[model samples]
Target: MSDAMIKVALIGNPNTGKTSLFNHLTGLNQKVGNYPGITVDKKTGICKLSKTQKATILDLPGTYSLNASSADEKITIDTLNDATNEFSPDVAVVVTDVEQLKRNLLVFTQVKDLEIPTLLVINMADRMQSRGISLNIPQLEADLNTKIIVISSKLQTGIDDLKEAIISYTSLSTERCISAGKIENNTITHPELLTSLSAIELKKVQHRETIIRYQFINAALKKSYKIDRSKASDLQAKLDRIFTHKIFGYVIFGVLLLLIFQVIFEWSSVPMEFIDGAFGSLADWTKETLPEGMFTNLLAEGIIAGLGGIVIFIPQIAFLFLFIAILEESGYMSRVVFLMDKIMRRFGLSGKSVVPLISGAACAIPAIMATRNIESWKERLITILVTPFITCSARLPVYAILIALVIPSERVFWIFNWQGITLMALYIIGFAMALLSAYILHKTLKIESKSYFVVEMPKYKVPLFKNVAFTVIEKTKTFVFEAGKIILAISIILWVLASVGVNEKFDNADAIITESVSKNGFNEIQEVSLNNKVIRFKQSLADEASEAGKTITAQEINSAIAEKTPEFRQAVIDDEISALRLENSALGTIGKAIEPAIKPLGYDWKIGIALVSSFAAREVFIGTLATIYSVGSEGDDEEANTIKAKMESEVHASSGKKVFTFASGISLLLFYAFAMQCMSTLAIVKRETNGWKWPMVQLFGMTAIAYVAGLIAYQLLK
Candidate 1:
């Protein structure tokens, strides 16, 4: 049989369990992407109806009604209004909550008026019995002129019934509930006096249309629907009183956030270490097993090491999204939004800004896009402008590495890990800075618009494991692929920049190393024969230690060998040689040119190069360091070498002191915490605001803040 496909659109009002049904139908088969020429997310999933037919279920954005108010709502209008649209559905599934059927039915009635073959899915059927609500399924179906399928999206009951109805779509009705004549020319002729209609006028029309639809719902539900007042819970009210309490709510939110950060640090460590070791081993094996050549070095040092830097952070990134997903699924996030509104309002932001700000922890691009729901132009802009200041996962790698270097592993107060505390503090700092900046921008930016904030307080439910798992998997994959591509490209370019030379100085590095080694009273063994020379030299160090009546531990002997033996010392010479070569390379010259600019921040030319490369992505700062350090790490045991160890052992070229000192680490941490280093975020800001002006100000303004903050941190600490 030839495969036939049907496009089935899933539409519903917000908080109606539309997404839960979508997740159930699609499972792991769903695809998430943006609609063409717009930033609004598009979710589509394929479900096998039979051997001969398939359904491409598109989950359109959730909206309250047909009257479009925001960018997300517009996507629904566009998809349903245009018959020629490739995504047009053969049958539209209107999902509604059984408990809130009155409000949910408003959307169904509006969609039915579009003359589309429609199925009404009354979700949460499990609650109907508990809530003592009963539907006259036959009477409602006959009156509404559509088949009604009652299902519990949570319990996965009655789904097969819905699927069977979907397969029999041709038998369903395309009869508009309200006549087309009633809404001709986007104007509704009603008892309430109104002239020609605009969007605002249509919203008023939509409001009256709600009342009209409820009249029909009321008649249909008269004998069909009944609610038991006794079945309701005071638990919801009791919990809301405490969770939304003025003093206690803030404390609970703070503690929960802190615990989340602590869990991220503690839980992610074992997996992160494993990933780091695996990638390091792979790169080591590549260098050792593959034949010596430019391509081999590029694969091992540039590609593998760069990839290592990214995948190693997957653990932390996954944990961050996991906690966030849990909060969202459990309905606690709504309370958080409500709790934050009063505080957010003082900063000229709507209460809805909490969603984007909280989501910004994952990535700024989506977070900024999430701001479209804010009805106020000024508030939305302010939210977008400051959302990046929230600590995103992109900064996790940089923060993780620097925090580990500067912060000790000891426990604080005999319970909290010092490193974990610092990480939590960094997260808090990001949030505080975001709010503070919003406050400042609120006072400065003059643009204002009428504001409205409305968020549904979803009833608390144990989060579904399937939904939470899917969310973590999808988000982690997105972070890896999206950030990995950039890191891979930059790593290759950086490799070439550090590999190639500007003059004969790099070409004669071998001779220069030999001359320097011999003049320093060390035996002159060429790079090739240095291994044999080092073996013999180690025995001499052992004899010298014995003659001096000094006990040399195995590690001490190895250190002695590393310092004196020609093979080990030759690696040192090579490292210095590579450093010089890099100093003269294209990337090195750029770093050198900017060295003076970053000098006060406790950064040298090498750090300057990393900073310049990192502007493409903040996460790549670690990858950049990995690529640069890999060049000089030749002959070191792959098992013992880590980026942190390499940095700890690095000697400053001018000061001969350790790089990444306490002062420098603090400065670097501060810089990454505040820098607007993501090009994608800047582009998104441009697209979102529909202009370059806002993004430019964001870029420079953020960069200046980062610079000043870095300067102050370094100066005070150094």
Candidate 2:
């Protein structure tokens, strides 16, 4: 935790158990952030090297070699090359698989050539014995000219020994294993020098360097380590036969996906309803306890409502990462990639792209960054462009509410539910669109780049509860805190727009109500209640605001009406007045103006306004509707129902039917599925693409598709 701590860079190839070691060392202390100049993620944590001594560890993106291929690999190369860089480690930990020792050494030798002390960690050591692998530790250490520590990241052994080596790093040599004498010291010392070569010569040098490094490693490993290839290969082949079978593998993948979606969809709702009510009650309590003023109003209407929209989705976020943890811990995702490679190849995407594509289900920002290992610019570009089309958690709120409106809440065959099926369908649609679009781009772009996809299939194990728990916590916190800030800001801006009007009618609501009540010659009781409501409205808009102990509430209004006349009749009259007031308000007028644009999609003006507000972020759609409804609502009953209920109750002015029809609901669902409704996603894309060009294409292009799709669905359904 102190500033004097030693910094360690943990580098490894994909599937090397690096993340497991990191989690064991850092526990819950890790923080994920972007490197200053790039969108590539930098994961840093403080690990206690000794009781009093701490070491800062940065888990660089996993890459197979020091030679850069993608944006993320450049980060590793940049950090490793710069001795003066902030994250440049005093020592580096090169974690590699013992079974694939020869292949892993390519990266190790490259790191050693950087002239930094490097500790070699042979992880997954527990599997070594069962797989009939053995190492001559002392000879291997001497031959490699560096310390080697064998550890089981799964069993948590040899970590202390690794720490010991890290502390004694000062005694380790900084000599290059493969001599860099032919290359200039400046080029060797700094990473950027590699970029100086032209394409042909650069490829030649990179190819030669790999050959030399492997030759050296093969020489070192002679008589030092042995593996029973038959035993290892037999187990992998046995599992691969069934799991990667053309028909059975796909069936298994499909069934597993259905289980996850169904479980998440069903179990998350219990917590979601509780969270929704808790926030709604909190807002009501705040309005009731705090003295009536703009501050209280903002707290109840703006901040609380904004925060509620996000917190309700925490269960969905938790389920997403939980399932991810299961796949990663069980080692099934790697095999899935292996099985899908052929199909993905036809779309001009590597199996490596599958990781980013699946992750796109949770969020696209880091998912796009995950494509760094794809090793092909054309494939990577296609992956990035189409990733946003995948349904992200941001669209979950929109989908959930809209689905509830159209799809019934009923179980299918006592095992499946209509709601769960719809949710899964959306995910499938997104992935389908991503692949279809990738294929189209492949045919059109005509760009070429190098492609390599070599992956390790780790032994399967039961998912550890601790690992799954941490993943859920980290991802859930990320969604709530990071995305929550944006929601809060947007909510405040929406409050101003929805609450106030542009003209005298919007401004003088109380006066307008007063004039109507007086001119209509209401009975004595109705007159008093009408005057009281106008007074309260005037008090709410006072230039010099103050705390008012007595406030008129919808419940109290209901009670007053019940005492004087039929409550239903009073509700109708009040609804008419409230509707009239909002019609003249600025937000309502804006909605009406845009009604024509969305009319074809089966949405009225109010839905149009919500759609426009949510253009910056889809989660804001429900909150936008809630805010508008709250602004125009006069009856106390509106507060009792959830946003889903309030929206369901909405009636079309011209048709007198519910606004949220089957046609409209399906149309909205389709629109949000394909639309680039999140500005943050676009901003990240712009940064990732190094310009606004691709982001602009994503925004306009995706929205155009969304519009057409929605129009078609509504037309067919209506």
Give each prediction's root-mean-square deviation over alpha carbons: 13.3, 13.7
What are the lDDT figures for the candidates, one per model?
Answer: 0.82, 0.78
- Could you tell me which 10 consecutive residues in candidate 2 have the lowest summed lDDT? 537-546
Please write out the lDDT profile of model 1 over residues 370-469, one tens digit for every residue: 9866657888899999999999989988998888788888876766787888888888888888999999988999885766554446778899999999
Any idea what lDDT model 1 has? Answer: 0.82
lDDT of model 2 at position 607: 86
On a 0 to 1 TM-score scale, where does candidate 2 land against the true structure? 0.67
Q: Count the backbone clashes (under 3 Å) in each candidate.
A: 0, 0
Candidate 2 per-residue C-alpha lDDT over 239-326 given as tens digits, one digit per residue, 9 for 90 to 100: 7667878888999988788878788878888888888777777777788799988778777877887777777778877887889889
